[model samples]
Target: MSARFGRLRRVLAVLLTAVACQSPPAVRAAAPPGPAARASGVVTWAASADRMGEGTAGQGYRLVVHTSVGGSDLRVRFTNAFGDRPLTLDGVYAGLRARGAALRPGSNRPLTFGGARTVTVPAGAVAWSDPLPGRIPAGTDLVVSLHTPDAAGPATGHWMAMQTSYTGRGGHTAEESGANWTQTTGSWWYIDSVAVRPSRAARGAVVALGDSITDGWHSTTDLDRRWPDYLARRLHAAGAPVQGVADEGISGNQVLADGAGQAALHRLDRDVLSQPGVRTVFLFEGVNDIKAHTGVTAAELVDGYREIARRAHAAGVCVVAATVAPFKGWPEWDPAAEAVRQEVNRFLRGSPDFDAVTDFDRVLRSPYDPERILPFFDGGDHLHPDDKGMQAMADAVDLDSLDCAR
Candidate 1:
């Protein structure tokens, strides 16, 4: 019996030794709930993607975007909305911009999807990166690096990004220095929305939806000088409840036509309603539609405005309409177009279709000639505003008007 007991003890000892010698089981803390699970963040930055443009095979894009409403848990949304084939992004990194293509060394961090290093976005679908753990400041120049091994068949992207972004070819350049990013492009690919977890004090965000003026066409490139940019600064300075500002303007965009990108009426749902935490929609389009000589009537434009307001209100977003700015000196200007512009402005100012109205016409038109853009404000073309004009337009906004309860 003693010998049998000794053998049993030896066996138990050997088992214990084996277990002790083996590697310990990995201990993983429970993952916090996703951002969608928590209702704390708002979209700080966004650009409207009109359609799928041409894309390079096995290329990388280092997109630079501006942010509003500082907060933690930065998240990015990539769109393959118009793609005909699957878009596979093998590497994606978000970092603070040190300059043009360079990033602030320690700021660059990898983003994951379901704990995966790579994410394949299906055609006509959007993908949100897992929340990155850290705080991002307001008005930050965020640089997002993305590389895809197989990107073909109408790549999804924004065509006219006023700011310059970098591009590269071959391997995963997302993790390397910007030195490999040799090519320069003035467009943003894949990336559409960037959201951040804001403090409870934040009210919500507002999207500025318009045309070239709203897209910052004449404003200095690489400089956040758009009226929306200026408005963001004003909101921050005033400590307004509405902190986040999304510029959803597309160059040459019209409210009634689909010529220069999708019309505002057609793209409203994607550009304005689908945005996260959007409390208000700042409507400042229609100039292009009127100027295009498409015979779009004032009543038709008014109806379009009403439809936009109806849709926005249904989505619990307030609508603030701006009267079209003066453009008498623009080559497209004619007596008929001028009549339409005036009639439209009259309806926009007096109509109850909008929650509130900002008379951008009053702010931008010359006192001497109500139909003409103020000489100082015009960016040589009389259609788009210069930097000073952009600032003035932003200054004209009533910060209180942006804060909506819903």
Candidate 2:
């Protein structure tokens, strides 16, 4: 028994040392600083988390995400929220994408956590990298390369990214040229959020929470034609106060159920509320639940919206609800479903629970058939909007509505 205890003590000591050595620099920097502290900025890009189908043990992923707001001192957030074991990321790099998997020369820079090159996020936890010194422009394609030496169990990532990313194997390729990243993928893995210290003139952020439409399903791949993307561009062009845009949409997701991903209600805290400098929550989901015909009534759906608004208001964030768009020709469309959509839109437009309302139904519906989508806007399948339709949706948004006092 004495011998066994001694061995256990030695193992424990070694593990403790390893963890101490791997502590991120941010952990140490948390100490009270002198009076000249820098002001923090809001999250400029984010994607809702969906189940990671499978995780590779010795692989790397180089994800390309477009920024919605430009700022300096960029930082990235990684999640292992669904993994069952600690996920170790040994190498991570951030750079501006030139094309394909290639990054602009001299733009790629190594990222460290707590001053260490490696970080091990425990199951169901998230870690934010220490801010990298540099300026990332709005609308720029930022490529994040990460290599995980040991990863398994369920991974946490955003599927149906719409944009193309690359993956590689063998040793860490985070700093190398894109030549080695031959495999292409349409999903963004591990990394979920990116933030920066914006200029004083820039305001906070708005998060778009919804299903497939908000997820940019029918929009052209790699084009960033999603409605939220369009909205971001508009904000930048107009110099709107709300400059940051986080699209927290998941394809096939619902407002009240976990079928496609964690329901909006379940993920609201992580995907919407927790983000820094988030001033408004744009709720634009519910078609899936109504069409699924799971007996979810209009009243029940309204209850979900009310709950979202209540939570957002409690957190001092404004709520902007969008009416569900017309979907007459969708396979699941029926009289009952149409009735629910209409009723929900009516409630959304009239509800005092929301700080503002955007009538997407009025914008996308055909005049001839109120329940049907306009032919010009339909992305075939009569559900999601095409690139033009996406632009229209963004145009319908009143930029001023997004700038709430909170």
Best by TM-score: 2
Native-to-model Cα distance after best TM-score fit, residue 107 in candidate 2, in Å: 0.4
Count of backbone collisions in candidate 1? 0
lDDT string, candidate 1, 1-406, tens digits? 2557534543553354234223221221112123343233688999987554556778988999999888898888888777777889978899998876888879988989878989998766777888999999998899889888878777767766767798888764555478889887777999888988887777689999998789887776677999999999998878788899999997777888665566788778777777778889999999888887878999999999999999899878999999999999888899899999999999998998888899999999999998898999998778789999999999999888897555
User: Candidate 2, which ten residues in sequence have the lowest lDDT sum?
Assistant: 25-34
Off by over 4 Å in 2: 1-40
* 287-350 per-residue lDDT for model 2 (tens digits): 9889987899999999999999998999899999999999999988999899999899889988
TM-score, candidate number 2: 0.90
Q: Rate the local accuracy (lDDT) of all candidates.
A: 0.81, 0.84
Tell me the TM-score of each prediction against the true structure. 0.89, 0.90
Q: 268 in model 2: Cα distance from truth in Å? A: 0.3
